[model samples]
Target: MKNFRREGNSNPVPAPSGGVVAGDGVLVGSLFGIAAIDAAEGESVEIASVGVFEMKKTSAQAWTVGAKVYWDGTNKVATTTASGNSLIGVAVGAAANPSATGLVRLNGVSI
Candidate 1:
């Protein structure tokens, strides 16, 4: 048991363009998830794959619980529109209308 080590739930990765902040949605290769803390360019930081986060969303539309959500990397907003977007997670709360952000339950699933 001396060599045993606890595995972490998060992984460190390079930041994307413009750098990444805590609570920011980051997409690395086929892995799309959230930043656990603020990280500058080229810096290693923890990225959580599964958690409930208040993410940016298309404020113009409403959301329902359990509805599939996609991460619009270009706009950095979560939307119900699924055409050529990465699957981030599901909406745990409802967004009545266009607003600042919405709640998303990140399950760490790929598109």
Candidate 2:
């Protein structure tokens, strides 16, 4: 139940997703990914939101996530995603040219 509020915003409101039953009041984090890169090139490693305050490397492929996402749950049961990937860490990729940004979306809730 750790909520990271953006700078200047002290509300620390809970970001819950709608339509997805697997998520609720849980927690979430920003979804970021590289864009514009060719599929033939070596892609960035995949990322997954491990709970609400940590991220883990789960794949060796590229992935994307909403920018608004900013929360993750507190259970390791659902450590990584099935297929899609989510960046839940503070370290961005070090590729020569990464997407840099993606749609900002909330996490914890389904999206």
Q: Which digits, one per residue and each the tens of the lDDT, describe model 1 over residues 13-85?
A: 7888788989888888867778888888877767887878898899897999999999898898898889888
User: Which number leads on lDDT?
Assistant: 1
User: Highest TM-score: which candidate?
Assistant: 1
TM-score of each: 0.86, 0.19
Q: Kindly list the per-residue Cα lDDT of model 2 for residues 1-111, writing each as its tens digit.
A: 379554321122223333112222222344322221222223232222233322323223233432223223433212224334332333232211233222222232243
Off by over 4 Å in 2: 1-52, 65-106
